[model samples]
Target chain A: MTDITIDHVTKNFAIDGRSVTAIDDISLKFPSGSFSALIGPSGCGKSTLLRLVADILAPSAGKITIGGTPPDEARRRHEIGFVFQDASLLPWRSVMDNIALPLEIAGGPIGDGPRPETLIRLVGLSGFENAKPAQLSGGMQQRVSIARALVLRPKILLLDEPFGALDEITRQRMNMELLRIWQETGTTAILVTHTIGEAVFMADQVHVLAAHPGRLVTTIDVDLPRPRALAMLQTPAFNHLENAVRAALFGDELKAEPEPAHG
Target chain B: MVGPVVFVVVLLALWKLAVTAFAVPPYIMPPPEAAWTAFLKEADKIGYALFFTLRNAAAGLLVAFVLAIVLAAIFVSSRKVTHAVLPIVIGLRTAPVLAIAPILIMIFGRGIGTAIAVVVIVSFFPIMVNAMKGFSSTRKNALELMHVLGAGWFKTFIKVRLPFALPFIFAGLRSAATSAILSAMLAEWLSGAPGLGTLILDASSYRKTGLLWAAVIVSMIMAYTIYWLTTAVEKRLTAWRN
Candidate 1:
């Protein structure tokens, strides 16, 4: 497990000869072994921040370090794993091969981590080892991707709306699956999501971001009990945290519009 | 198999009926029975010609297959190379191979090698174009996944791009298989060689209507067989797609 520190990082993209800042001078620290979620409206740079930490994009200013090492170095050392919105498994490869991809890329003797077969079972895909990605349903495909991401046993895992495409029931099931996997692995996880409930339920801390030169508006620490059960969602405490995150987003939206309520 | 055989038999029966019903002149259109008789009488000669032409077609397709793969690789490696070479290929592909055949015969003289060359020229482009499209059509996220895995360019091409391109390549091969025989026969016709194309020409010149019809039918059967064979190969290789 490793801590990720973002020190005043900013990202700007040039379009039509005009500069647009996606993430604007945001700073935060994700201590080792913490589960943090960045949630806000679309275009609030949640995905961009996760991408920066994954070393997929470079910061225009400031720095991001993983366990006191640069993001690039951590990525090169295979300490960072990422899951995109889509499962993105190669359709030709079977479930086992897809999960084994990271190990194949690493190209060495089996490291001291969970094996690919073990991960297939971990993701609840034990019987379909030889089945191609096309044969599996969307949720099953996402599980394969999750197993693939964890195959390298990365120190930190980053997810960008990994379950956004699933139905609500499947999404909740995957959420529980992810929580169990996280607990078992003890790996630091950073998720970029648009769902307030998901962030509150899944994260140790939630960072609410605001759009239009995206910046972090606030960080809410989830004071929920550890080894959270599904029943916790029905509790008053979970509802309160969910309401607080929703209110922050609603307030940001209202502040941008500058309109009064008629009713 | 039974369906094609039945359809062909019915078509042949209709042709026989037409010839007998209309009392058509043998010179204009020989009766189906006359062609069948000719095929039986010259069975040894016809079989040799069939083997020779089929060999030419197979050899030409093999050469074209290799050339297409190499050129497709080059084309995929750099846009500059594709830009420089593709216009000429498109030009060659669009212009009739028949027009180029006479000039090639004039330059290289009448030989089996010249015929093979013409077949190669006629059949290589489709494979190149299709294979190029296939190799380039690798999913963007697949490439990004490779990048995240720290996979090198060669590994990405072999493991991802190549497999993705197989179905397309097979599609190209099916088309090329049909064209291979046609180009070989055309080459033989221009070069005055000993294959079925030359047999057709000789029969026409000698006014042997039965022999001419028989040779044409033989050529049709060869084309059909090659098409079927290619389809079978494609099915076996890409069973996963089903």
Candidate 2:
């Protein structure tokens, strides 16, 4: 129910006694209820940007305001949820307990919002409420991770390559599942991934980022229809959208840069 | 399991036959039959002594468990405390328990307290080291997830880190279980207390080879029982890790 404003945010890291820019000065606004994706290659700091927005890392310059508050404040309000590339579930807890963790942290009444059992069913893990994380497959574990993240009913969902470890089929299935959850919950999701198709298929706008100094190259708006399906991947408009994102990622200046010298 | 039992039976039979064939003196080594007779004859006394040792060992283990958990919490909360204390803990672990037992015996005065203290000293190190390792084994990203969820330290520990450490903690307990009994027996022997260790010491002093062998065998059986119980508990509690 809230928009995110990234106003001139930049992040720098001190690596080996040298200041390296992980994210260059960048600015963007995500409208309320929008599904956006940040697509870039490795080392592009898209994940870093998401982490900053999640308040896990602070920006070196400028500010990021979610809804009307800062990232940290929003986090305290239980308005921000983050999912990592790894499932990261505690191995000893059952699927139900893992999903119940955020609510427990908030020190509220049990299963008060979107109930653990309901979220489990939404993630297609209804039968696995008692299963441990280790017993689930990689894709299934990620579903549990998703359920856990959504348990708090945060206004914003931040995913950093959440399905990057899964195979193509599973990843696509998860993308569809995510889109369904987003539509159902109406939570603004900002996914950071390297895959262009996933970006085009799931996002209302794809924020293409360049490498090295990780800055925004362009933002592509996807004009695909509502309730996107696996079959839409074969449509001309979907291919066009994918190609446009790819061009933004690897076009023009990429062709002009010379190759590095061999060691 | 049956195979091992059969092997033990065969080995004991071979021992009996070897002693008979060699016409070995009873003082040097008793036959298996004589050892068995001695075991039955002194069963009541040995059983009472064994129960005493087990109780003291259990008390020592309980003390060590609580101490290790508290120390692990301190170590996780502050690196400065860990750095200041861990070296000393490790050094103390390396100091021989035998060397300290006499001092403890003098202070505690030939009682269960002395044996329990020795058991705690011998078993403390493994639990502390393993629990420290387990607590520190939390994933970096998992911690960040906690940050995003706005979970405080207590919530994070209860919901994430503590459960993550259960397997490693159980590993420490398994090793500690054996040392608990061993150290207790040693303390009992040295202090001339009422335990299987004292029984063995008395039999040896009186040149009762049969009773000595029986006492040693009983101690082995107790150790095996402790090992099996620990493994069973570990399996039941941590079946998810399987």
Candidate 3:
């Protein structure tokens, strides 16, 4: 099923010979084929959590499991696909080549996974297959990265602010495209984001985190129906979910603001 | 194009004028015409010497390039090795090539081997250092992507790291190439090889000032041409950067 479970995971960094806790004993679960979002301000260690799950960085304590296997095992089996904020495509490689990179790394196509050309069309980048990364705009480059992330058809998709660099209009469009792709692939997706609206709109469950020895504050489930549209952004239910996530994120400060204004 | 041509013409005219005005002796400074006449008379000899010198420099540079890349890969793979070996490399680089040429000739014998060794010793440092920087400077995200894909070090190096390091490698190559001919010529002088460096020394010892000046001019042109050619190849390879 490829569900992810983080059992009391923690991450620490050594700065100036002192151990600084980045993620403090946090636990969460992302069920199979479900989309979840982690939202927090900077220093919240949301990115670190993603890295830990991808086995790019190890947890200082506790354990992480994808389906029933450890992250490293899942990773070695080519079951984890990560999309970074910067796209990170090789400048020398064309779009088609960049998307095909993981396949090459895996020692050729793993099973009956989608081909690079199929992914190019899947991400709606049809004619630009031969174009180099530098020749594309930021949004187009991100699309290429998304296509690349999906090329292997990994069971779990980890996105670390993939649309954070784009303009708002483009961000919403990419978000919609991502949701459609996630639904089609049926991957266990976890998105780390800063925007409350994005977290509420794209995720089935939103996990709020607090900084300074980062810890989870709360998890809010969105009741919004799927095949979510741009028009759903103005719906009261979406606004309500967004507010719940905001409250979880800025609960103390938000409560204090009303008293100061009233006084 | 026009600017360089005009500059060269002006430079030649000034050289001709200075020699005529000062009435300098041919040994001290031959007129431009004297050097040109000497080049035409000994064209075959000068051509052969030039060909030999070019071959030695090219061979040495190719060896150095491959060696530098392999060494850089090893250094990048381990910080302990880099820390241990980099100082010795730096020490070698700081030690004067002139000081080492005699020992190299004794070891390698007075042949093209000595010339190639000298060229490698002279041109290796920049390429190796620049290559190390390039290999290390690969983007963190790219490396992470490789990690996520479970690509081993060799595949990562070939597919991602090597291409990323091309511009830096080329930078080092260009720097090495400009000096490559100079080092090869120097080696020829010490080893008594029949290259342009030996030609220059022989012409001067025989008081053939015209031939000496001609050899110097030809060598200067070769150095500039090598630099231009390296840059041209770099442009073609890194065309995606534009």
Candidate 4:
């Protein structure tokens, strides 16, 4: 449970003898014990920014201080956990083994411990201990990945479209499940998503990034209410926030179009 | 039973028809009934020979399995060595096993050991190549999951990488099993105590074409048995794939 402060984070990728800027001069701060959603149109560097915070990719310029230390330092000591859009659970590993992966990597005594049993229950994967990834459904497999990321008990969890591959019904159920898990665990989550409704439903703050030399366009705080149910999505307040996020994205798309031939 | 049984029946019928149509002498080509009668009369000898070849085939397959896995592990652990040595391994696979059998016989003599060695050499390449390809085919997402979870290189290899490679390795084994039986018989033709190869040679020398046809049938059964055994193992190990 800690804050992640990004100070002028910029990312450049080397491609075909040219450097392409993915994220440019973006400064954002995610406070402690809060669920923040990074919402943006595709290719707006939302994933790139999340990867930088997860320490998977280093920024070409600028610094990110995670929990008062560099993400590089944070990740190595296993202070941050990350999940990709793909469930990414090892096909060969059973659910228990997948969940126990962090402990195995951390190289500690793996025995009857209080935390391990509690974690299995927390994810609602009680009877699926021996089930392999291939044996489970898409939703169940994603749950294993989530359990694995949280196994290390990191303060910050970074997710890059973790439910993008699941069906709409599954995704909605997952959002509810995720909220339940977060409420119980109190771990700060930074979810990078494209769904405006999802952003409004999940986040305390939704940070929107606009493309074409990608940078943050706006940040909107959702003071809607706590324990936000799926039913809240149809409310006027949710509609208002969704419209705001939609307008911000629409404005960016409008600006990105090639201008009509001028004299 | 479905495809191969139909294939064997068609093949035997064609051979019988050719023998009758050409008016081929009994010593040259025996009819299906005569071949069947000869096969029953000499069942004990054929059975013994079949057992001998099977023993050699099983031994060879085991040897090839061990060697292929070790080589694959070595190649995977060190990329530079794999890049350096892979072409030569592919070249070995290209060399026909029959072409090399006599040369191997000259070196090791026409004994069971030579027969086993020939089968091992013949079968090793496919297993090694399949294992390499299977391990490398591990999904990138699966790997990232392991990495983020803190699984080390060896742990990742055994738990994640190895199980994923099982289907491919078994596929190679199923393919190699056929070659394994063929190579063992080829080696037995050159040397060995008393296998189907010896029966074939004795029948050919005595002008007993019917007995030779029977020996051929026994050997075919031996080869298919290996194939089916491997296929069964494949089915059990990779029930998840289906």
Best by TM-score: 3
Residue B76's C-alpha lDDT in candidate 1?
A: 94
Pick the winner on DockQ between candidates 1 and 2.
2
Second chain TM-score, each model: 0.92, 0.91, 0.96, 0.87
Q: Show the lowest summed lDDT stretch of 10 residues, model 1 chain A.
A: A102-111
Provide the global lDDT of candidate 2 against the true structure. 0.89
Writing each residue's lDDT as its tens digit, candidate 4 over A80-109 gives 778889887765567887787778776753
Following a full C-alpha superposition, what root-mean-square deviation does model 3 have from the true structure?
Answer: 1.6
Instruction: Show where candidate 3 strays beyond 4 Å.
Output: A257-263
- State in Å the error of residue B34, model 2: 2.0
- Pairs that clash in candidate 3: none
Number of the predicted model whose DockQ against the real structure is largest: 3
Clash-forming residue pairs, model 1: none
TM-score of 2: 0.90
**Share of native interface contacts recovered by each model:** 0.30, 0.84, 0.91, 0.33
Query: Interface RMSD for every prediction, one decimal?
Result: 1.7, 1.3, 0.8, 2.4
Question: Which ten contiguous residues of candidate 4 chain B have the minimum total lDDT?
Answer: B143-152
Question: For candidate 2, lDDT tens digit of each residue in B1-242?
Answer: 99979988998989989899999999989999888999999999889888888888898888998889779978998999999998988887788877877788888888878887888788987887788888899888888989898988887787777777878888998899887888888888778789888888899999999899998888888887888898998898778777
Q: Write the per-residue lDDT of candidate 3 for residues A147-225, one digit (tens) a residue.
A: 8888888999999999999999999999999999999999999999999999999999999999998999999998889
i-RMSD of model 3 (Å, 1 decimal): 0.8
List the candidates' TM-scores in order: 0.88, 0.90, 0.97, 0.82
Model 1 agreement with the true structure over B75-178: per-residue lDDT tens digits: 99899988999898888778776788777777877877877788888889888889999999988778877776667778888888888888999889889989
Instruction: Please state the error at residue A56 of candidate 3 in Å.
Output: 0.9
Ranking under lDDT, best-scoring first? 3, 2, 1, 4
